[model samples]
Target: MPLRVHDTRRREKVDFTTMNPGVVNMYVCGVTVYDLCHLGHARCYLAFDLIHRWLEKSGYDVNYVQNFTDIDDKIIIRANETGEDWRELVENNIATYYRDMDALNILRADKYPRCTEFVDDMISITADLIEKGNAYAADDGVYFSVESAPEKYGLLTGQNIDAVRSGAGGRVDGTGSGKRDHKDFALWKAAKPGEPTWESPWGPGRPGWHIECTAMSMDSFGEQFDIHGGGHDLLFPHHEAEIFQGECHTGCSPVVHHWLHNGFVNIDGEKMSKSLGNFWTISDILEKVDPYVLRLSLINAHYRSPIDMNEQLLKDAEKNHTRLMGVYKAALELMGINCPPLPEGDITSQVPLVKSLGLLEKMAQGFAIAMDDDFNSREACAKVLGALREMSRMLGILEGDDLGAYAQHCVEWLEDTAGSVLGVLPTREQTLVEPEEDPRRAEIAQQVEELISRRSSARTAKDWPAADAIREELTALGVVVTDTTEGPIWDLL
Candidate 1:
C-alpha cells in the first residue's frame, strides 16, 4: 500500500509522491518565540514529527526544516513589557522551546532558520513582487496585491473571497489602510518607534510574518518541495500568502506539492490559545505528568480532528501509556532482559522454543496499512497494542528463558516501531534515570526507592498485610510492582 496524506490544498487524502523520489523536503511552520509553548504548539509539532519519523522509516531521506519567527510584533511587545531586549526575549523563549520539545523526544529539524537571518532574502522577494506588480509600496509599508493573483488566492481555504473581502474590511492593521484593497495584506512593515528595523529597498522596515517562511524555506530547499505543514489556523492568510508570493516569484503553480495542517487543540472544549487565556503551557504539564502521556493525549486523536484536552484526557493517556510500557518491559524481561524497576508489571511463562518467524512482519503490515491511509495514528496505535498482546501470549509459554533468534527479532522490531518510529516509548537508555536530570525527578526517584525498600523489608519479615499495603500504595501512584528471584521491581504507570 502507498502512503497517503491529507493535502489541505485539495481538502482530501491523496497518495504522497515526493517531487524527488527517495528524498523528502519538508518545511513545518514553527514557533514565534514570544512566550512558552502551549498544547496547540505541541500538537502541531507532534503530528509533523510523527510524519517525519514515518517517512524515514519508509526509506525516504528526509530533509526537515522548521523555522522560528524570532523577530515579531509579539516579541517586541513582550520585550517592552518585561524590560528585556527584544532579541534577548526571543533567545530566551527559543531555548525554553527546545527544553519543552526535547522532553517530548521530538527529533530536531535539520535547520531552524530564524526570520532575522533571512532579511536579505525577504527583501529580494519583496522587490520581485513589486517589479511584477504583485505588490506595491504604501506610505507605511509594502502590501501584497490580492487582486494580482485572484485566481490562485483562497485556493487552500476554499472560503468565499467576497465574504472574506467584506469580513476583512478594517480588520487588518491600520498601516494597511493605504493598500489598493481592504483585503490586501502587508509584505513589509515600516519600523515603528523603538521596534527593530532593517534597511530594505522600500524603506527602513521589517518583513511581514508570512513572507519570512517563503524566504527561509526557499533558501533551504529549492523553489518546489515535498511537503509544507503547519496548524490549520495558518491555512488562510499565512499559507495562502505563501502560495501567492512563491508562485509569482518562480512561475511555479504550487510552491509545495503537499500542504499538511494538523487540526486545532482545545482546552475544555474551547480552542486552546494564549490569547484566549485558557491555554496550558507544555512546561507546566510536564511537571505534573509524564511527557509520553502528553504526547499520547495529543496523538490519540486523528491529527485532522479537534481534541478537547483536559485532566481526564491526560489521565487516560497516562493509563494507556503505562499499560503499554508495562507490557513492553515485561516482554523484554521475559527474554532474560534485566533492568531497573519501573511503574508497570507483566508475566507469561512455561513452554519450549518455537518459531516466532514473521510475527513482526505481520504487525508491520497492519501498521503500515493504517499509517499509510492519511497517517492515521489512532488506527496505527491500535495496531501496536494488538501486536504487543499477541507477543505477550507467545512469551507466556516460556519460563525463565533466553529468547531464541526469532523472538529477539520480534522484540527488536517492537522496540524500534514503538520507540524510534512512534516516539511513544522510551529507549533503554531513557528508561534508566540520568544523574543530571531535573532535581524534582531525582527527588521522586528517591521517594519511590524508599517505598520499594520498605516493601522489601515487609516481605522479608513475612508481614503479608503490610507488604500488600505498600504495593497497593505504589499502584495508586501509577507504579506497577513485580517480584522475581532477584527481588522486587517496579515501573512507572
Candidate 2:
C-alpha cells in the first residue's frame, strides 16, 4: 500500500498520492524564531523528519520545505521588551533554533523561506483576495471576509461559519473593529510606529500570520502541494485561514492535498507552558541527555498522540538507546566495525542476509507496514528493538565463521533502520568519545573475545581451572561478565 496520513481537513486516514508521480512536495510550519525552542518544538520537527526519511526509503524524490516566521508580532514584542533590534533578535533566534535541532539530528529542510523575504508574494495574494471580493479593507488593515465564501470558510475545522464568527479568537460581534464579522481575519495589518513595516497594496504594514503561509506555499509549489504539516493547535484559525485564503485566490478546493498535525507535548502530566513553570527547552535537556536518546524518546509514541514529559520519559529513552547501542556496538565488535555499520548490501535486504538476513528483511517489511500506515513511528520503533533482541540472541550461539555474514546482515538492518533512518546511532566522533575513550578498547575488547573463546573451548573439553583462570583475567580487567541462558554477556565496568 502507498503512504497514507490523517488529513486534518478530511479528518480521515487517506492515501497520499502525489500529483506528479514519485515526487512529494511537502511543507511544514516551522518555528516563529522569537525565543529558544522547547520540547514541543522538538516533537513537531522530529515527526516531520521521520516522514521525510520514510518517503526517501520508499523511493520518492521529496522536496521538503519548512518556513520561518521571522517577522511576527511576537518577535516584535519580544524585541521591544528586551530593548533589542527585532531583526537582530530574529537572526539570533534562528541560529539558536538550528543549534537545538541539529543536536537532535533533525534533518535540515530544503528551503526555509522567511516571511520577511516573501512580503511581496503575500501582498500579491492579498490583492487577489481583495479583487475577488473575498477580503475588504478596514481602518486597521485588510480583513478576509468570513462571509465571502460561506460554503468553504470553515471546512478544515468542521465548524459552520456562524459558530466560528462568535469565537473567532475573541473578536466579538458588533465590536468597533470595522470587520464584516467577528471571524474576519486580517491579510494585511496597517503599519504601526517603530515596528517593521512592509509596503503592501493597502498600506505600509506586515502580512497577517495566516497569509504568510498561504503565500509562501503557493509561490513555492503553485496552487497545490502534497502535504502540509504542523501541530494540532494550528488546525483552527491558522490552517483554516490558510485554506480559505488560498482557495479564494485560485478557486482551488484545497491548497494542500494532505494536512498532518502532530499532537502536543505535556510536561509532567500537565500541559507545558511558561505560566506553569513546566516548560522544558531542548537546549536544557541536551545538557544531560544524549541526543540519540532524546530522538528515541520522541519516537516512542505515535506522532499524533500527545507526549507526556517526565523524568522517566528521558530515563527510559536513555535506557532504550543504550540497549540498542550496546546491541549495535556488540554486533559490530562481534563482526567488528566501529562506525555506523555498512553491510555491503541494499538497505532493504533485497539480496538476502544469508538466512538471518531473510528474517531481518521480513522485519524490515513489518517496519514499513507501520510507517506506511500513517507513519506509525512507535510501531516501527518496536520492530527496531525486536530485531536487535533477536540479533543478540542469535549472536550468542552462532559459530564465529558462520556468524560473519549473518551478523553483517543484522547489523545492516540496525544501521539502515535505527541508525541512518531514525538518526539514533551516534556519529563517528561521538562513538570515539564513549568512555574508555581509548582507541585501544577495540583491541582490548577483541582480547576479551579471544579469552572468552578460549574459556568456551576449555568448558567444552571439561577443563574447569583454565575456564576459571580466563574468567579471573576478565574480572581483573574490570569487565563484568554474566552467564545467561543464551550464553555469557559482558559489560565494561
Candidate 3:
C-alpha cells in the first residue's frame, strides 16, 4: 500500500507523493525556546520523528527541516524576568531542547535553522512583500495586508475574510498598531528600548513570529516542498499566515504538497495547562518514567487523535515495554548473544514446535500495512510487539540448526520494524550493561519474603481474609505474588 497522510489544507486523507519521485523535502515547525519543553512538544516532535522513520524505511530520501524560534516575545519576557541576556536564555533552552529530544530518541532533522540566523533572509522577504504591495509599513512596523491576497487568508483554517475580520476563525496579531485591517498580521516589529534589534528595511526591529518560519523554510527548501507539519494549534493564524506570505512572495499557489498536524495532548480529561496544575515538563516526567515507556505512551494513540495522558496510560505502556524488552533479551540469548541476566523470578519455557514458514514475512507485511495507512503507529506497534512475543515463546522449541537461524530471523525482524521504524526498542549493546544494584534491595527482599511466608501460613490455615490482606500489602510494595503447583513465587513489579 502506498503511504497516505491526512492533509490539513484539503481536510482529507490523500495518497502521499513527493514532488521528486524518491525525495521528500519536509518542514516542521519547531519550538519557540522560551522554557523547558512539555508533553505537547514531545507529542508533536515524536509524531514527525515517526513519519521520518517510516519515510526512510519505505525507501524515500527525506530532507527534513525543523526550525527553532529563538527570537520571540516570550523569550524576551523570560529573559527579563530572570535578568539574563535574551541570547543566553535562547541558547540554554535550545541546549535543553536537544537534551530532552535525544533522551526520547527522536531522530534529528537534516537542518535546524534558528530564527536569529535567518534574520537577513527575513528582512529580504519582508522587503519584497512591501515592494510587491503585499505588505505595508506603519508607525509600529510592517504588516502583511490581508486585503492584498484576500482569497488566501484562510487557506488552512477554512475561514473566509469575513470570519477572520469578525475574529471568529483566526487570531488577530495585536502587537503592532496602525494596521489597516484587523486581520493584517505583523511582518516585522519596530525596535523597543531593551529588546533585541536587527537592521531591516522597516527600521531597527526583529522579525515577527510568522515571518521567521516562512523565511527559514523557503530558504531551505525553496518555494515549494513536500510536507509541512506542526501541532493542531498551529493550524490557524500561524500556518495561514505562512501560506499567504509564501504564495505572495514566490507566486506559488500551494507552498507545500501536504500539511500534517498532530492532535493535542490532554491531561486527565481536560487540556493541559499551567493554570490547571496539570502542566508537565518533559524533564519532570522523565525523572519518573523511562524514556522508551514515555515514547510508547505518546504513540499509543493515532497521531491525529487526542491522547488523554494519565497514570494508567503510562502504567500500561510500561508493562508493554517490559514485555518487549524481555522478549528481545530472551531472543538474543537464544542466538548465543550475551546479554544482562533477567530478573530472579522471570523464566522462559519452551512451547510446542509449530510450522514457522513465512511467519517473519507475514509479520513484516502486516506492520507495513498498518503504518502505510496514515502512519497508524498504534496498530503497527501492537502488531509487531504481539508477533515478537509469540516468536519468543516458540524460540525454545526449535531444533539445533533451525533454532539459531530462526532466532536470528526473529531478532532481525524486531530490529527492522520496532527498532528502526518505531524506535521503541533499544539496541543489544545499549541494554547489555548491568544495572546498578539498589541500596534497598536486601531490605525489600527480606520484607517480601516475610510477607510471603505469612501469606502462605494464612492460606494453609484457611484464613482467606488474612491471606488477602497480606497479598494486598505485598502489591502495595510493588511485588506480584503468584501461586504455583509446588508453592508461591513472587517477582518485583
Find the candidate with the highest TM-score and give its number.
3
The TM-score of predicted model 2 comes to 0.84
Question: Considering TM-score, where higher is better, how would the candidates rank from best to worst?
Answer: 3, 1, 2
Instruction: Work out the TM-score per prediction.
Output: 0.85, 0.84, 0.87
Off by over 4 Å in 1: 165-176, 274-277, 336-360, 400-407, 432-493
With candidate 3 superimposed using the best TM-score fit, by how many Å does residue 81's alpha carbon deviate from the native? 0.7
Worst lDDT run of 10 residues, candidate 2, spans: 336-345
Candidate 3 segments exceeding 4 Å error: 166-176, 336-354, 442-493
Clashes of each: 12, 2, 0
Per-residue C-alpha lDDT of model 3 across residues 208-245, encoded as one tens digit per residue: 89999999998889999999999999988899999989
Top-lDDT structure, candidate number: 3
Query: TM-score of the candidate numbered 1?
Result: 0.85
- Residue-level lDDT tens digits of model 2 in 94-122: 99999999989998989999998889888
